[model samples]
Target chain A: MKEDPFAIKVENVSKKFSRNLRRSLFLGTLDLAKSFVNLPPDTTKLRKSEFWSLRNVSFEVKKGEIFGIIGENGSGKSTLLRLIAGIFPPDDGRIVVNGNVGSLIAVGAGFHPHMTGRENIFLNGTILGMSRSEIKAKFDDIVKFADIGDFLDAPVSTYSSGMKVRLGFSIAIHRVPEVLLVDEVLAVGDISFKRKCMERMEDIRKKTSIIFISHDMRQVERICNRVMVIDKGKELYTGETLNAIDFYYKHTIAKEVQNIDPKLIVYESTGDIYNITLNITNEKGENTEIFKHKEKIVFEFNFESRSEYQNPILGLDIVSPEGITITSLKNVIFGHQRPSIKVGHNNFRVILEDNSLMPGTYRIAFKWRKQDNFSLVSATGGRFAIQSEPELVPFGGYFKVKYKWIQN
Target chain B: MEYKTIYTPNQRFKVNIFKTWYIMFRNVYDYRELIFQLFKRDFLMTYKKSFLGIAWILITPLVGIVNWAFLNYTGVLDPGETTIPYPAYVLLSTSIWGLFMGFYVASSNTLNAGAGFIMQVKFPHEALLFKENFQHLVNFTISFVIIITTLMLFGVKFSFLSIFFPLTILPLFFLGSSIGLIVGVINIVAVDIGRVINKLMELLLYVTPVLFASNTENENLQIALKYNPLTYLLGVARDLLIEKNVQNLDIYLIISLVTFLIFLLALRLFYVSEDRVIEKMI
Candidate 1:
């Protein structure tokens, strides 16, 4: 065996599987008979109850690269990983793995319920390719990392699924493999353990190549050096992590935006009557309430007055889900270079060149408060949702800011 | 070991059979510690909740012998008279037959039992089969002690040839495992094959002379036993230790040759098609 620079190189790979047992057996018999005659079965032709899962996939990963694969369920991401892990042969093309691969594809697998957690550590570690002495040396560390405490002596069946996963994950990472295949196994652990796992993964990434598959876009963005987006068994994008995430958001999330009136959350009026309408246009110049992250959005308001009012303040407040007002605009709050407003009809346009709000629904409340302790009309205007591009911090509560960390 | 590029698609890449065998055995050798650990796990897990625990291995075979002895002693089921006592005859045969049967069952179910490990981990899948066989071998060793006690109770004189008794049974283990490996692979896709094999084992127990000596008066039954490999295997094991002479040495040697060939082919087939079989299993 010669030394190879690349850790993983998959070329024009494809996989096909049968849906049921009867057809699988029939196909097996046919393949066996054909093998006797030295005739290769044709992979291009599909028989009944068979379908191709991956088609013509090709990529190469450097020795220390942390590669990420992002796709929805049934997008063939797991199939691709399995092929690369040598779990099965591809129906067509070639996959070259130049180093030892340790997979965390299904955590806590092969754990016997009757065995103690301590015993299972050795069992699972050996399954992941750790030698006996290697496991013996790391036994205490594995227990400490898993944090099962005194329950380590207890049978694995007595432990919860989380505990089993913790033990399994600990043993898998401790193997110090050259190529690691992770498939959504980290999602099973708790928040603190997940953080610890992320740190451990980062440490390992400097020395080992990793192929990560996850639906958690934030996690992928945080650690992956490169990302590949797959949909329905086809490679949609493969390049820089940020660009692949953007490609995924534009196709899957951003395309779901609709041009509909935002729901009114709150409304109260005492005396004065006014009619209001809100409309938003996206960067594409099409009238849409949905806008991508940092995309320019034009918010237009059309209002009509039934009675003449004096010194009325027109205010707009954008409130996040936590009811915190992100930013508010009022004519009196800023230095006044006010536009004249007639009683019959008026149009006010606000163009936000960098609408940097995070990805979530936001309520836009409009209020017309009179000067000197009198209120005209205070009510919710409309709501428009933003679909931000994938970021490292998902579900961070709809607030995106610009800052960097500096340690003292 | 140096890093090498492993291609996925089945290609015209010629596999050196000798090299593949060497690598396969080398992997098994390297993972020997793992094999022992797995065997211990299976051994402990099988009797984990039971009060008897390890004693059950011996107790189970003892109960079988007692039940068969009672029937034979009552003359309700006459195993043709042997030079040795009937209880000793039944006891020895049952233990030997049980060992072979255990290998067959373990071999056939090893892959299915380790399906979870197969799907999630990348290790020598053959090691699991070896672990299963090892577990059964331990069980058989424990039960073999009861056979020795029965031999002394029947006042049977053992010859020096009894030292080779354990070595003789080794071929029978391989013969059962050869069939096990082939049937196990087939069972992964066609599960009914395993069920059929299980039923055939029951029928085979009656056909083989495990519970009785060969009755040449019944020509039809004798002819069937003559062709059955187990008949020659069990005959050699029993006569060498008890009767002090193997009746069918020529036939036993011929069967041993065939068993060795079958084992080689079975192992080759398993190693070659393991990945494809696992894909379907998934």
Candidate 2:
């Protein structure tokens, strides 16, 4: 059996952040009183108010592994990073790091505006645990990597945002700690610089363990050997990158669908009195088939009515898995009016031409009502998955348009 | 791989003062380059954007001297039995007092000002305080030079006592640093202390004999001033600069030794608590 290679072990870690200000104040007063009374500080008591940001977050990253933490905003991913970096001590539980750690939670965090870049370099390097001689040795490399040549001598306040970040990143990576904690800083640099930073991170990852927190799932998938999803401060899943991302999307989609009120369902009215059947159709008009990216699709609603309402309106909307309205279509643009349904059954079909959307699962939503008053009479929705043909196009999004290729 | 382990998994709490001191000193020495870097940055940045540039150092002490001269001329502060000119007296007192004030302010606010460094980076945070304190040392040195130059220009008598200026600042630095370390620690654990210290320092300026010489006849105030370490520091500076060799050497020696010990104790406490306290607060 292979031995576990993890250098850092976080066991049953839970962190709480109190949202209540009054509770915090009360607890602070009590702690003050206790200290004055010469009593030992009670570490376990929350006093009056506290909430856990992370609950039973347990995971292990082997030495020299690149681990990604993926979550939406307010997911407590950053809090975990801070805890591991020792910026904030854990309210409970233990995190044991076998070696030195470096964190770049925010670039240029300590750079004084009035001080020059060269001056800040020494300050920043020392803050990252580098001695003067060590910084001096790496001075040339830092300057070269920052690429802010003559501006290094100028005050850092004069440097642009990119320049400052570059200088900061250069110093941080040069520290060469055993563990590196990075938080969303990769998104700040330009394309070339970002690529360079990624390359540097890859090189560093071979020798150091890294915990990278990012919202960009693609980037996480690209570099991380493993991934963890945090939701509401709890570990939703942790495993391989692809599996974690798939679980995240599934969980998010289910949560969103459950949150939507079922009573908002719309139904056809003022038409032939017949049962309306809503069927999701692909670009080829095939039923029960997953749609392909950039393929034509349609929501064919079949109904029978005794009489048709004049100037009726029909609409369809496609919602992303995350509940964001991706696209909406209406019959008004097609120069079609809601024909009066005689006292019989009728069929209504809303066609979506050239659905040029990225390859992702989406939900089909339908709405129908009389043209006037526009009261939502009936609505029904269902999910659809779009599968991209990688052979036809590169493995990115589905909306690849025609363009002239020229070489000078 | 059979091995006999002497250390247990959960060890009892041990307080090793010598080991802690060793670690603190080693860390400071390792990061000493940062000290000079911060000092240079602070010293240069202060004068960089100013139109008057380095002249502000000279102008500051000059302002103190002029303020005292005007106050004395209007009989706001009675010139004591000492025959020293009021401007000279104020310059000597204010320059040394300025050093103490500068060190105190810098040290007191070191953690607050360097919170950016504390929260985002993993370094020995005490170095930030030391770096700020050292920068004030540089500023004091620069201001002292200006004071000495002005005295020479005014044709004030220069004697062997002038050599003691450096020695005088050593005791004053230790004294200021002790107060600063204590205040810095308190400010980190209890933020309200910072505001209170600032207000108290302002009030203390009047009570501390920075401008007027103490009259030996006023036994009560004199005794009270004697207990104030800052008074001893300022007096030593004045005696060395204005009174020449007529200063009391025995008093200076006793105060210096005592202040040094206090400073060492404060710094030791600061080092032990700096890492854990900063993490908790920020």
Candidate 3:
């Protein structure tokens, strides 16, 4: 593939932040005291103590390419954008841009509360490096796009969050920068406005390169031509959008499960000389099928016990990647009994049908305990990837609904 | 390919003061429309909420004249000995003083007002400050017009030399802006300087010959007051308005030259520390 010429070059860029928030005043005083005492400063150790938010992270953004940066929280995606925007100088390495850059890091960031929308538009335009005449030429288009006709003359403090975001987006898009940096600004505003902004971004991408940072995986997939996944200030993967999201889930979610201590999985209860094996099956009743949206999943637990107890309660739950409990099941509600294993094996199965779930990955967990004491007996879990089948699902997510449009 | 030859493999970041100033001026020029818009917004919005509207501009100086009259009546000020009526003297001093104080206050706080823009946008950091200070200049010009009309109402003689007031203010404006730029940049890294500047301005009010005339007989005080550029500026304004004589042309020229040099020096310091200081502070 031919490189479209590097519009922005980030070479070995690393940004170090002072980890010690308490050191601000103390460092100032220390510097003062050092000069007074005539002592050699320990600047070397202080520099080393700083935390690197982005460490030797390098990437090239081609002209007219929409580059998406996907990551979990605190993964330095916003920091990278700030660095490229020249908000701060990199402690080590360099970032070079070939043309003018505009950033929409946060909606309404530069808007003054006392200034009216009309005033803020010019102020923000100037701040974004737009000439007065340039802003004047585009002023009407900006107001029209924001859709806040009469309110433009009113103070920005009076504008709603959606209104603020719309005006901000309108001004940023009007700037016509050679490189545009956007950071999760689309998460605000209504759905229609979001679509409008997406379309505007698409239009701008024809002439300018963009670096978009967002936590919304689907949105990234929809807009970005290539996506990069960052984890713990390291680049995990950078390539196709789908592959990056998959790598992110695998490393951030699955790897977390992989790191769980085996000893932590043990639970205390009645001493039973037996073992339990958990198997997950999809709606098709196939052993290989993991999970699907609105599809039933069966948890088959095969276990053996040395002796029978009075009652044993069994529970199962499906947890999302972020540890959100999507759904759970308990045998106690059904008044089920476990037959004596006689030092052998026994099988128990629970089926969850038509599970209303969002199209994302999930984990299945199993738990068993004595009925009276409610003490844990054993617990285990395995990974399950819940997906939406393109053929049947209208939209992939937790909730399913239908809507009709009428042409008037 | 042509691309291979056009795209250099290695390019270094160099810090050039002249280049930085060029960028700063280019950005300010480009954003001139926004500056004018903000100026108009500030000018109109200020008078919008007032009960008297634009008359407040004349009304403020009239109040000051009335206060001076009371002071003179009580012998706090000697009217018979002064070259001009107490009201005219007070009006001239206050008009020029107001311009200086307004520019000083606005320029010093320029960075604070545009902090968000500086952090988010890729423009000359000083443009925001300059635009804000320029707004104060417009306000001062408006108020000066009101003062001149009031002076005429008082039956004071006016001459062509009075036109020099605007030229006289240009040097003072640059001087105040230079000081403001330095203080504004310092305040970005350390907020303590902002508070200190307010307190320092208050202290300067008493020491400077704005409210009270400095006695020429006191050799020590005269020399000290001469050292203050603001004193010379106020003296020039008073001479032009009241005495109708130009005093110390060389001093005014020296002040102008010194101010221009300082402004250039401040601009250089700002460019050099632009990335290192503000980036760390913000």
Candidate maximizing TM-score = 1
Tens-digit lDDT track for model 1 on A1-408? Answer: 456778999888888877777898878766644543445567666789987788889999988999999987888999998888877778888898877888989987778898989889888887777888899999988889998988899999999888989998988888888899999998888999999999999999887999999978789988999999998788889999888976776655543333333755336776445566777777565787666668787777777766666556777788765568888766664566456456788787767776777776666777766655467667774666676555623445555678888999
The full ranking of all candidates by TM-score, starting with the best, is 1, 2, 3
Candidate 2 lDDT at B236 equals 74
In the range A1-408, model 3's lDDT, one tens digit per residue, is: 555487788877776556664454345334333422333233323353466677777888888899999888888888788778877666567778867778988765667776889888887776677777788999999999999979998988889888998998899888887889999999989999999998999998988899999977778878888888887677778887777766665555444544433222445546573466677776555774335556787877776777665566667877766677666787665545654234467787788765766555666665666656465465656666555343332254554545798999
Pairs with steric clashes in candidate 3: A131-B30, A132-B33, A358-A397, A358-A398
Candidate 2: lDDT of A223? 88
List residue ranges in candidate 3 displaced over 4 A: A1-4, A20-49, A112-123, A131-144, A148-158, A254-315, A319-325, A330-408, B1-23, B46-59, B72-75, B79-81, B157-160, B216-219, B280-282
TM-score-better candidate, 1 vs 2: 1
lDDT of each: 0.77, 0.70, 0.69
Models 1 onward score TM values of: 0.81, 0.76, 0.76
Instruction: Give the C-alpha interface root-mean-square deviation per candidate.
Output: 2.2, 6.6, 7.7
Best by DockQ: 1
**lDDT by residue for model 1 over B42-149, one digit each (tens)?**
788888889988778878767866775676568665544787766677778877888888888888876876777787776777787788888888888877877677
Rank the candidate models, highest DockQ first.
Answer: 1, 2, 3
Query: Could you tell me the fnat of model 3?
Result: 0.28
Tens digits of per-residue lDDT for model 2 on A33-142?
44333343444445445767788788887889999998877889988888788765565677777577888898877677888888889878876777788899999999
Candidates in order: C-alpha RMSD to true structure: 6.4, 7.3, 7.9
TM-score of 1: 0.81
The structural similarity of chain B in model 3 to the true chain B, as TM-score, is 0.82
